[model samples]
Target chain A: MTLTPKGEARREALLDAVLRVLERDGASGVTHRSVAAEAGVPVASATYYFATLDDLFVSALRRATQQQVALFADLGEHDLRGFAEVMHDWAFTHRGAAIAQYELMFLAMRRDALRADAEAWYGALEHAIDPERLHPVRTRVTAHAIDGLLLRMLWLGEPSTVGEIEAAVREITSAISA
Target chain B: MTLTPKGEARREALLDAVLRVLERDGASGVTHRSVAAEAGVPVASATYYFATLDDLFVSALRRATQQQVALFADLGEHDLRGFAEVMHDWAFTHRGAAIAQYELMFLAMRRDALRADAEAWYGALEHAIDPERLHPVRTRVTAHAIDGLLLRMLWLGEPSTVGEIEAAVREITSAISA
Candidate 1:
């Protein structure tokens, strides 16, 4: 159903609150009541927009995916160093969003309904790597490699330095170019 | 604490039950009651052996890690083709174990106590790459790449063929060798 302007605004507010709750409390912290409180709305507002917690999670993940896509859209224009710098900066500044995304990915492993969102997120990574001038298979492998590295950094609570990021980016680019 | 042989056997049984529960029900499915039931032990036995659910989960993860390290110990003896073949077979036959491992990794992302297990798991992967004849940094990157690829395969419910695994492995070896 098409929402009115006010309805759309409220929906966005709720989605924003989902991220807030995720960042603050991790996945377990994201209850309807908590999200509603975070959004400064009645709990009914969350229930009114989202039929269940799964729906709310998917909405938030979709929003986060969109933001990531936007962030990576111009990656092709930049060199490997630039790409690495951007990613390194993002890892430091957006740890919460990154953690939430990984959590959602793990959640999707068990829930079939969330599979499409996970696939779309992977597809976005593929899209971002399209301009890297690599063979298709190489591009896919490299994308996953970068993904794994980033995941390790996040899980280990080790932020990637610019030098390390650049080295990884260079390795991928060189490997693919060859 | 030291225990009788029977006690050690029961503890192992409990840990095995944790993996079974994790595979069948996911992380949320794991509880003292559920694990005890799975193990065909009294609920009190579970609590007697493990003080809390977190303790049980960590013990299971540690056991899983030891098993993985054992599996990969001889990986350096094989060529990439052999390594890929073994991994592909494991992915198909031991899918539950793989899923549980990823689940535990995600859990470790939120809980600090599980981080060492995750690190040990990663370390095992790094050791397995010694046969690739690459620099230490290259080995580390390739390990993470293989991990990322395996995780994607598990998440997408698409088991990798030996051919696909070999190709990816060959790419990493060749990239680093060059």
Candidate 2:
């Protein structure tokens, strides 16, 4: 159902709170009451908005993915440095959102409802790598390496600086372009 | 701590129980009592075996990784089909252990104490890809792509069958070898 302007703001606030909770406590820590409290909305309002923990999580992940996809979409075709900066920002600067996205991936493994969102995340990576869809096989493999690199940055904290990350990106692209 | 044969058996049982509980309930569902119940051991035995939840999780993942590492180490150099079979079995047939290992990776993101186990996992993948450490850069990038492909298989359930998986593997390796 469509909501009033104020209701929309509250809904957005609740979704934001879900990411924060997910970042701080992982998936199991989120609940309607906790998220409502985190969002500064009434407990009733959270349930009214999301209705369940899964709703809060799935909605938040979708929103995060949209923002990230937009970031990738805006990049120039050969912007390795630009890509690295965005990766740094997402994996290090906005780390909570990155963790939230990956957590959603793990959650998606069990719940088929979240599969499309997970696929959308992977699709965005592929699109960013080859917006023109040229070299589909090469693009697919490069995207996979980039995806794994992103996870390594989060889990292992390697290529911690933008320069190093740019180098890592260059390596993958050059290897595929060979 | 040293243990009698029966105690060693009980400890292994508790670790096995942790994987089952992790697969069934995700990470947060694992507690001393819950794992003990899942393992058919008393709560005291669970706690005695693993004093805390982190201990339980880390130990189980380490064990699973060891088993997986051995499997990878046994692969012949040109055995892409064998690699595909192993991937299928790990992600599907013994699905719980796979999930349990991934869940530990998520946990390692938060806890530095678990970082070594997580690193060992990536190390195993790289070792599997190139046991002699030749073509370091190529191996690293290929491992990243392979890692990403594995995650996609688990999350999106694509390349579901062994033949499909082997074909996907071929695509990745051929793209890199080009």
The models' CA-based lDDT, in order, is: 0.78, 0.85
Residue A16, model 2: lDDT of: 85
TM-score of each: 0.87, 0.94
Q: After superposing candidate 2 on the true structure, give the runs of residues whose Cα lies further than 4 Å from its correct spot.
A: none
Query: Model 2 residue B134 lDDT?
Result: 85
Model 1 per-residue lDDT tens digits across residues A101-142:
777666656667777776776777777777655567667767
* Local accuracy of candidate 1 as per-residue lDDT tens digits, B80-171: 88788767866767777777777677666667777787787778778777755556767766776787777777777654688977887787
Docking class of 2: medium
TM-score of candidate 2 against the unseen true structure: 0.94
Q: Score the docking of each candidate (DockQ).
A: 0.50, 0.76
lDDT of 2 by residue, A1-178 (tens): 9899999999999888888888888876889988989999889999998877777777887887787788898888877888999999999998866887787767657878878877788788888888899889899899989989998898888889999999999999888788
Predicted structure with the largest TM-score when compared to the true one: 2
Task: List clashing residue pairs in candidate 1.
Answer: none
Q: How does candidate 1 fare on TM-score? A: 0.87
Could you give candidate 2's per-residue lDDT for residues B14-61 as a string of tens digits? Answer: 888888888888887899999999998789988887887778877887
